[model samples]
Target chain A: MDRLRQHIEQITPLTNEEFEYVKTFFSLKKVRKNQYLVHEGDEVKYEYLVLSGIYKVFYVDEQGKESIVQFAQENWWMSDYYAFFKQKNAGMFIECMEAGEVLCSTLEAREKLSADLHKMEHFFRVKLTNGYVALQQRVKLLLSSTPQQRYEAFSHLYPDLIQRIPKKFIAEYLGVSRETLSRLYSASK
Target chain B: MDRLRQHIEQITPLTNEEFEYVKTFFSLKKVRKNQYLVHEGDEVKYEYLVLSGIYKVFYVDEQGKESIVQFAQENWWMSDYYAFFKQKNAGMFIECMEAGEVLCSTLEAREKLSADLHKMEHFFRVKLTNGYVALQQRVKLLLSSTPQQRYEAFSHLYPDLIQRIPKKFIAEYLGVSRETLSRLYSASK
Candidate 1:
């Protein structure tokens, strides 16, 4: 809860009373490695803010191939956001890669908090601005970057996550083959 | 400026006084066909909200291959978002494909507007939320969708754009070969 307060305050500070009120809308949940916080077809009721550990938000197509959409770590938020906002069944899965805790809040909670606190709205807007930029870069990499370029860019962008995430998942996230990723890794070393 | 006021009001209604203050931060520009609003290496200053016509946002890699990132039409916003938010040089280009009018605002103006008006902050937050979700869907399409699927999805997601955008640019946007896009086009027929 203190971490949550710190995270919020990092953007916009709140008084003890305001913080307490904000916390009322959030519930802390312990997530085990391999836990699926969101499953395909299930209602995306809560968006989670990771407190620790790693998680992957992904899509699995009809051919049963997994496409990593985004990854979440401590202080990051994850949900089948399209489904969450639209109140539809999840089209993506959010699976924990390592044991950790996350603070969960409903979309209603988010809107209520924003409506109640202008600072919260500003905080959310700022967070989304950064998220939007990251996604734009992702699209650019997907569109124009070569395998080596993509690998290097990914490494540079998520150096910490590179060390923590499995090489296989990193390979998938880059849309590069295992062999190519291995080649890039060895070449870089 | 009525359009700007209407756009802001669509999310959060603004008072006459507030709207008057808000409009001061924006300048409207009429763009002609083939005009470049942004070019790689230029200082990225403003994000634009379209009032008419179509614009293509794209990137050019080392080999000078163009990759279409997005097409903006009436009511759509376009910018080198990464650079715009970071106050850096543009890494992508925004070129007008059809003559149109756009409202432009600098990052400072954006921040000032948000700080001055809580309603404006909420409005921006909601827009960013939708933009974030749209980007997530774009990433998903890039990572997992086959060419045929991508074309169909693009057609479904932006039916109006399909009718207006050139097939070649659509091919680039979908990361499909021109021939493949043509095949998909005919196959659908």
Candidate 2:
């Protein structure tokens, strides 16, 4: 697949045998729209790469209000990252927003990959570094920007993302209420 | 020197020759209280390890109000990380709160070390992974907690830190203003 080829290229060049070895760990699964992929308190067993459709990662507070943290579409990766990488209980839930397919790999497989290939370890190190960079930028945006500005910035970055997801989910990600988002949206319009 | 030795031990075992090689890149510098170590827009050419005392990394808005982003004290490493690692203009200015001493290394020296020794590269990667983990926790805290809860969490995590930096700086890092911080501080007290 083009996606698999792209993913492999991001890491070190894999020999045909090594590629086959790594491929053994990945299992493909189909997800239905509106289905839950992971829930809070459950252990996250794998990191997934999306092949098609969209998924939302969210956290629910004690009051049962959900706050969307991120959305992953085609070719993007989604997981309860803290749980998957650090071996902890899920702090967030991931749900399918559209019928999708994903390639999944578990922690045990990742460990073997790391052990078998130093270059693979380097690939993962770079992956985590890039994640850290994104997280830092997100924190800065939360600190420096207003809700309207954040929404605008999000629109600019992912022009079709808002069109695909619900308004309430967008509000939650921006750390605002649905009503507030409605007002901002109406005002901007 | 003792602090430097301790810092090195926390990462990896270094041979005498390796230690000598590392020492060549680091120079001890004393920062006076109320003075800056790096400024916003300046190049972040060096990384500093706090040997003693306290420092704050903060960003000033267009309005000239400072928002603290990080604090470094004894045994902590401080830098405009976004700038230093990405080789961009500094995102924050680092300043000494109390007269402090730091063991400093330049970006060029670190690159040379990485190229010269595989062990050093592994050591740096491990250190970077630990830093990445801590930053991930910080991002989750920022996303999931209220300002009051965040402040409380910070105090719980770093009991000694409260004694070193002012309340306003802590509030800034938590994404709140001085007046609000003053109120929260008094209420908690």
Candidate 3:
């Protein structure tokens, strides 16, 4: 689990024993492309750490429109965080955009880890703070940027995802139509 | 300091010694009505806990149109968190809508608290996690709710703030115009 070790190091370096203790809670799972991990209205039972693959966190409006909120590639964490920690029904659906593997930990295991290891608790604490900061920036982006600017920002933020996901998904993530995205791309070119 | 004790109690019980240690960093500050506490693009050096009064967090567009993202009332925390934590220019402006008092803490104090007090560190971690959940739900509401539905939801979520803030500010918070908010209010009645 080089990826797991590296991910934990990004927060706070852990000893081999400490990593092993934390690793006891995580189990690797494979998801096929287009498969659902968690659906809207279901309780999100696990927080996933991407090992290899892409995932999209999105929601369907009452009128059946899909709005993509986030894309989690390798090294990113993905979950209906609102549901996972709160035990509430998810407002978003998480699905595999490309077949991939993820290290999964349930809420029970996470809580137990918090009680058993203060270091794990601190790791998650730093993660949540960083997560909070990221969402605040996203909200600001939605408020301050134009659709064209958003596209450019998206391209810069996830350069690899640009070639991997369909144009429609990118358009939806930027809150624009496919046609608008095409026009913006051509204009920039 | 009474407010800090109360706020901490709402989240988790802290011992008197722990609370006292945490309280040393905060100083009382008064913000005048219509004055900015933190501005977009300014480095956010402090985070405030509202002791009394109301504040608005908003961003202005290129056209100078303001959209209120949130309003902080009594006992709520206020900051351009992105800037406060990241040491970057803030993306939102925080202004006092009504003259108020707050307890302020700087980034240095925040880091020191996390290192010095495990209980305080745990308390903030839980609080930030809750904040992240609330923000995700707000984004979901924006995606799925109509203006009327959003106003109704907002009414249910912050009836106290709605009663205290000006209608124009509420409209901005909901991403609607004054006329639209008026219609929604009349329709509800």
Candidate 4:
């Protein structure tokens, strides 16, 4: 897809022939709202690249409370990465939040692509570097940030997602109560 | 340098010539206990790979409360990664908990090594993949797990760390109060 080419080219340029080869590894899938792309207990066979729309990667604990690990929008990648990398059964679920499409590729394909092309290896390394930093920031915020600080950081980092995502999910992601989130929301406005 | 070669070789083997070239990019530093590798507001320049001893990567908030982000031991790589990668001033500090030796490499060196050697690129990518998964797991634990669950998970993941790191720092890392960590510690034994 053109979007795929654009995403890859954002990190490293691919020749037309290389792009053609790379595209073969990805298959497109259309998902509907509320559809589950990955479910807990199933083998996590693929990691997806969002073509359009939004999705949430989350897990439900023993107490039956759900905690969202991350949200993936267009051009973002999503999977239960721990399980995905280890080739184990999923410990989380990736649910479609809006009707959209994604390109799916297996770990084998990912390894093959990187091994076959130096540029592709560089592209993946850069992407992972960014992802690693974002997760580290998220951990720090979760550990020490106040509700107000968390809300502010989330808003600053994802101004676009604030309006697109439901306030309830935003509250959960911030680990803030709905009332507190509402107060912060109004104050910010 | 042998440790460095061994660490990289765990993921991808390198010829002696390749290993020799790679080792030049890193400089060895001996750290004293209480010495700070990184300080809040200082520009982060290098990421260190631990050869021996322990280090805490942490931050002090406005309230003067310290939170441990991670602990680095032998064979572990540690940095204010978000700052290190972005070439920005650190918001956290990495302090040596015990006298140790570290191999310090710059961002420029990392990129150059990866560009020069495909095996090095693959090695870095694999390391980041594991680090990313570990951080994601931490995020999930922080968001939903109870103190007991967090302690158990940490123990399972790093059994050696439990005895090595002080209970006080472990409490901060797990986002648990000292009393709660004491209870978990006693219960675990």
Per-candidate DockQ vs. reference: 0.89, 0.39, 0.57, 0.89
Error of 2 at A20 (Å): 3.1
lDDT of 3 by residue, B47-160 (tens): 998999889999888889898777998887879887888888887899998998999999888778876766666777888888898787776666446789889989998878
Candidates 3 and 4, the one with greater DockQ: 4
Clashing pairs in 3: none
- Candidate closer to the true structure by DockQ (higher is better), 1 or 2: 1
DockQ of 1: 0.89
| Candidate 4 wrong stretches, greater than 4 Å | none
Per-residue C-alpha lDDT of model 1 across residues B78-173, encoded as one tens digit per residue: 999999999899999999999989999999998998998888889899999999999999999899788999999999989999999999999989
Predicted structure with the largest DockQ when compared to the true one = 4
Question: What TM-score would candidate 3 get against the native?
Answer: 0.95
Off by over 4 Å in 1: none
Q: What lDDT does the true structure give each of the candidates?
A: 0.93, 0.78, 0.84, 0.94
Q: Model 2, range A1-189, lDDT digits (tens) per residue?
A: 556657866756777777777788889999999998898999999888899988998888666777777789987777877677789999889999989899988988766776566666656655665666666666666776777778887878787887898898888788777898898878877
Evaluate residue A107 in candidate 1 and report its C-alpha lDDT on the 0 to 100 scale. Answer: 98
**Model 3 lDDT tens row, A96-187:** 98999999989898778866766777777888888888777666666546788888888887788999999999987877778999998889
Model 1: lDDT of residue A189? 90
lDDT of 2 by residue, B87-122 (tens): 899888999999979989887877677657655655
Candidate 2 positional error at B149, Å: 1.7
In model 4, which residue pairs have backbone atoms overlapping below 3 Å?
none
Q: Which residue runs does candidate 3 get wrong by more than 4 Å? A: none
